[model samples]
Target: MNLQRRAVRQNVEKSRFELPVDGEVALADYVLRDGVMLFTHTETPPALQGRGIASALIEGALLSARQQGLKVRASCSFVVDYLARHPEFADLQG
Candidate 1:
C-alpha cells in the first residue's frame, strides 16, 4: 500500500498528521513554535501497529514541516530514532 496516500491528510488544526486505517486513524503529534516543529509522539491503533502507519505519519508530518520552511525538533524518542536512521532528513533538524 502507498503509505503516502495514507498520510495525505494533515490536520494542522489538530496538530497531527493522520492516516486512516481500517476505520481507525494513526497519527503523529507535534507542537509548532518559533519556526520549529516539535514532533512529540506517534501512535497507531493496536490493530494498526506493524503496518508502517507511524512511519507514514511521521514522514508526512516532516514533509509538511519542510514545505512550510520549519525546522524540526525531535522530542519523541521514535522521531529521534527515525531521524538517526534517515540521514536525508538531517537538513530538517533544528
Candidate 2:
C-alpha cells in the first residue's frame, strides 16, 4: 500500500489559498467582495499535477469559505469542475 502525505492549506495574506508541494506551491486565487468570494485562478506546478494538492487547496478554501459563511463564485474552471464533482460545496456557490 502506498500512503501519501496530505497537503496543508494556508491563506497567504488573504489573497490566495496555497498548498506547498516539493519546492512549489499550488494556489487557488480568490477575491472577496460583497459577502462573496470570486475564485479567480487555480494552478498547480506541472511537477505536482498528480499529487492531489489542488484538491486539497480547493477543499480547504471552500471549507474556510463555508466556515466564514461566504458565498462563492467559481470563475476558475478548475473550481467549477471541482464543485461539480463535490456536491457538498455546491450549496456554497453564489
**Scored by CA lDDT, what does every candidate get?**
0.83, 0.82
RMSD, each candidate, Å? Answer: 1.5, 3.1
Residue-level lDDT of model 1, residues 1-94, one tens digit each, is 4655544577879987788878898888889899998989888899988877777777777777888999999778989998998898999999
Overall local distance difference test of candidate 1: 0.83
Clashing residue pairs found in predicted model 2: none
What are the clashing pairs of model 1? none
Per TM-score, the best of the predicted structures is 1
Badly placed stretches (over 4 Å) of model 1 are 1-6
At residue 7, candidate 2 shows an lDDT of: 53
- The global Cα lDDT (0 to 1) of model 2 is 0.82
Candidate 2: Cα lDDT at 77: 97
TM-score per candidate, chains pooled: 0.89, 0.85
Looking at model 2, report the run of 10 residues with the lowest lDDT sum.
1-10
